[model samples]
Target: MDIEIAFGQPRPWTETVAWGPYRARHADLFEFVMPGVARYTLEDRSRVTVTPEDGADEAPIGEMLVATVLPSLIWARGDVVLHASAIARPGQNAGLMFVGASGSGKSSRLQRAVGRNARVIADDSARVYLQDGELLASGLPGGMFIRTHDAADSRTLVSVPPEQQLKALPVTSMLILGNDDSPVRRLTGVEALASLLRHRHRPRILRLLGTEADFIGPLGDIAARLRIAVVGVRAWMP
Candidate 1:
């Protein structure tokens, strides 16, 4: 089997790896090679060769593979994968990203912002890339998901099925939703760095790769170039 993703340019694959109901291909969509012993082969720019290992059931593997590979594919095409939610609008050069623990109101705030006319660049994950030294945020193929009860009340909001809602957004402005009722405020220097560190992706993975320092350098650069904030909500809006 084969899968193709067209992001302005065509990426084709021909290797087949069956996992659960999904089969993944080693197409040109990947910029980095698969880490570890997960076998894969690329054929006809459209198919992948997949051999399931013992205990490696299909469903989890399929989900893990996509999550691991999609970002590299997106980055290969000159996009940055941010672990946050993003929103933007006309006249704004960059967007805002909200990141926090699950049920932290990140999506709810973004929904509110969208209702206020902010264009959603991405709901859960934001794709950011630097062009001519300027960071720009772009939308992913998904949208934010709210609860069914909230969904009915937010008919005017741009939403999608719960399963398809995103949890990451491109990094423009990093907002950490505080549990308290304090007002929102901008953070810089150490405060900003601490906040970003709290939300870094796969912290253990980076440590194992010995890339923690390398990762921090770039994150610091991003923090310096973009706005970072922590906002407090009075209640569980969602």
Candidate 2:
């Protein structure tokens, strides 16, 4: 339940960090390496062990936690975590979520949603779970998808998390945001499953941990009840 930071004494990686970012080990333990930050090990889906790179700043470590580490832990615990964003509007009963792969415009749409004064349930890596047969989403502590042009690169995003702890909000609709000409359409059955599977956070680790197949039933229920659609990037408030 705590992050143990280690220096000098590094955990051995079977493969080089550059070539191997993720290693599929025993179901109880998982270890991964990320450049420009630190090496991370998820212990039994409960605790985190971090090995910072030489002179690595704590800022990058915090960013990587929200980016991958935290979500990996949540995903390992059997929750349906997606590299997606969620937003809720006033007087609305259910929140809306946007899901897509990297560079699919999910973040841009999220920035726009926040600009519209919509309440942010989560930014990237929306942690979803079932509560009494109802699907709900809870944002990670530092949940906000914001890219700073002044930063090192175009992919560098700074997250300003909420001031207080966030609560899980019911989700009734999900949209796959894309720039393509794909008409706005509802996805169901195999289509929904396939789309959702593609955007799962750290799917390789989940598959290695033998929990990927466990999502079929839960995802089916989520897709069947919720309005999962594919919306073009130009279309908003869809």
TM-score of each: 0.57, 0.83
Candidate 1 per-residue lDDT over residues 1-238, each given as its tens digit = 1245322222444434443332334323222233332434333445334544455555544443444444433433333456666765434545667787866677667777666666666654455555577766655534455534554434222444444333333445666778788877889997787776776533433332233565566667667877877777663232
Give the best candidate by TM-score: 2
What TM-score does candidate 1 reach?
0.57
Candidate 2 residue 31 Cα shift, in angstroms, is 1.1
Candidate 2: C-alpha RMSD after superposition: 3.6
Output the lDDT of residue 200, model 2. 81
Query: Model 2, which residues run further than 4 Å from truth?
Result: 1-19, 149-165
lDDT (0 to 1) per candidate:
0.52, 0.71
